[model samples]
Target: MIQLTVNGKPRKADVDPDTPLLWALRDSLLLTGTKYSCGSGLCGACTVHVDGQPVRSCITPVSAVAGKKVTTIEAVDGSRVGKAVQEAWRKLDVVQCGYCQSGQIMSAVGLLSKNRRPSDADIDAAMAGNLCRCATYVRIRAAIHEAAKALA
Candidate 1:
């Protein structure tokens, strides 16, 4: 059994040691907010916070996170920064097709948690890995800046 804390709740899962955290989350734990776009970890769709640092869950094994804290988009609104990010996303209307918005928001929240006032370059660098086929980069950047202001 692999032990871990997900969205602030302690849990255990009986699965292969090599099972990707994404599967453990989506299948075992039933937390599907974390997407599975690029299984190789190239895309940021599977981003989740492991001990408050954004990590690609698709490439992370369940055994690797034993006894660690895992935070998903489901619990993001529980924090001030996350709520601000969600509000900013809504006010800015940053979603187009919305397939990748969760991941985008996850990345945005991760960036804002560390840097409250991120510059254009900072936002770009932080969000570079999260691809939005709808091409909503402008709105995403604006929402990140807006969330930073709200958190300030």
Candidate 2:
């Protein structure tokens, strides 16, 4: 049994230690907001916060997260930074196809949580791994800045 805290709730899953956290979250825990794109962890679609640090769930083993806190897109709005980022996304209409927005939001929330005011280069470096096929990079960057301003 793998034990962890997800979205501030303690949970246990009866899965193999080698099972990827993405499967544990989607299949076992029913947290499907974390998308599965590029299962090899190259793409940031499977991004989630493990102890407040953004991590690609696709490559993370469930066992590795034992006794740690995991935060998903579903619970992002619970926090001030996350709510600000999400509001910025909605106000700016950042979603194109919508498939990648969850991951993008997750990455953006992670970036803003650490750096209250991130420069363009900081946003680029932080979000570099998250690919948006719709090419919404400009809007994403703008939304990040907006969220930062809102937080300040």
Candidate 3:
């Protein structure tokens, strides 16, 4: 059994040590907010927080997450930055097809946590991994700025 903390709770999964964390989260833990796209880390759809730092779950082994905290979008509301980002996302309607929004939101949370006021360049640099097929980039940028202002 691989032991890990997910969404602030202790979780134990009887699975292969080499199994990817994405499967552990979605299949065992049932935290499905983290999407699976590209599966090769090219897309940020599998983004999740490993001890508050954004990491791609699809490529990370479940054993690597053992004894560490894994924060998914389901639990992002636990932090002030996360709350602000989520509120901004909701208020601005930043979701397009919604398939990528969870990853986008995770990436945004990672960005805003380090920089309270991120410029467009900073946002772009941080969000370069996440892609929205609906091309919601404009609203996303605006929402991130709005969230930064709200955080301030």
Candidate 4:
């Protein structure tokens, strides 16, 4: 049994240690908000917070995060930064196709949690790994700025 804290709750997953954290989250723990795309971790669809840092769950082994805290999109709104980012995302209509928004939101929250104010360059650098098929980069950047303002 692999033990970890997810969304502030203690949980156990009866899976192989090498199993990707994404499967453990989606299959074992039933937290399906974290998406699976480009399983090689090239895309940010599987982004989640492990110890307050965003990580690609699709390529991360469950064992790698053992005994650590793993936060997913489902619980992101619980944080102040997350709530601000999500509110900005909604207000700015940042969702294009919605498939990548969860990851995008996760990454945005990650960026804002550490840096209260991020310039366009900082936003681009931080969000470089996340891909949006609909090309909503403008709105995403706007939402990040809005969220930063709200946070301030």
Candidate 5:
């Protein structure tokens, strides 16, 4: 059994140690907000916060995060920074297709949690791995800036 804290809840997944965390989350834990795209971690669709840092769940082994805290989009609004990011995303209409928004928001929250004031270059670098096929980069950047301001 692999044990971990998920969204503030203690949970256990009875899976192989090498099983990807995405499957453990989506299949065992039933938290599907962390998406699966480009399963090799090239894309950030599977982004989730492990120990307060963003990680790609699709390529991460469940055992790798053992005994650590894993936060997903489902519980994002529970935090001050997360709430601000979500609000900014809503106010700015950052969702285009909506498939990748959860991961995008996860990455944004991760970025804002550490750096309260991120410039365009910082935002780009932080969000470089996350891909939005719909190309909503403008709104995403705007929402990040707005969230930073809100959290200030």
Candidate 6:
């Protein structure tokens, strides 16, 4: 069994040490907010914060986070910045199709926490890997900016 901390809770899984955290989170822990897209790490759909730093969980092994705190979208949405992001998303109606919004919100929260004010290029860089099929880029950008102002 391998041990890891997720969303402030400690848990263990009796799976392969090399199992991707994305699987462990969705399958084992039942925390499905972090998505699986482009499992090779090119996609940010599986973004989560490990020790407060956003990481692509699709390519990250559970063992790699042996003692680290993993913050998924579920837990993150309850925070100050996170709540702002969620509220902004709703206010701007940033989601379309809804499949990738979780990941998008996760990435946005990660970016806004570090930089309360981000330019369009900064938002692009922070959200570069997350692909949205419905093309809500304009709304996503607007939500992020609104969330930043809310945080500030």
Q: CA lDDT, every prediction?
A: 0.92, 0.95, 0.93, 0.95, 0.94, 0.90
Error of 2 at 109 (Å): 0.9
Per-residue lDDT over 3-85 for candidate 6, one digit per residue giving the tens place of the 0 to 100 score: 99988989987779899999999998898888887899886788899998888888999999999998999898778999999
Question: For all candidates, what are the clash counts?
Answer: 0, 0, 0, 0, 0, 0
lDDT of 1 by residue, 35-72 (tens): 99979988888999899888899999999999899999
In candidate 2, what are the lDDT values of residues 27-108, reduced to their tens digit?
Answer: 9999999999999989899999999999999999999999999999999999999999999999999999988888899999
Worst 10 residues of 5 by lDDT: 94-103
Off by over 4 Å in 1: none
The window of 10 residues in a row where model 2 has the poorest summed lDDT is 98-107
Model 4 misses residue 93 by how many Å? Answer: 0.6
Candidate 6: give its CA RMSD in angstroms.
Answer: 0.9
TM-scores for every predicted model: 0.97, 0.98, 0.97, 0.99, 0.98, 0.96
Give the clashing pairs for model 1.
none
Task: Give the least accurate 10-residue stretch of model 6, judged by summed lDDT.
Answer: 35-44
Off by over 4 Å in 3: none
Q: Where does candidate 4 stray beyond 4 Å?
A: none
> How does candidate 6 fare on TM-score?
0.96
Please say which candidate is ahead in lDDT: 2 or 3.
2
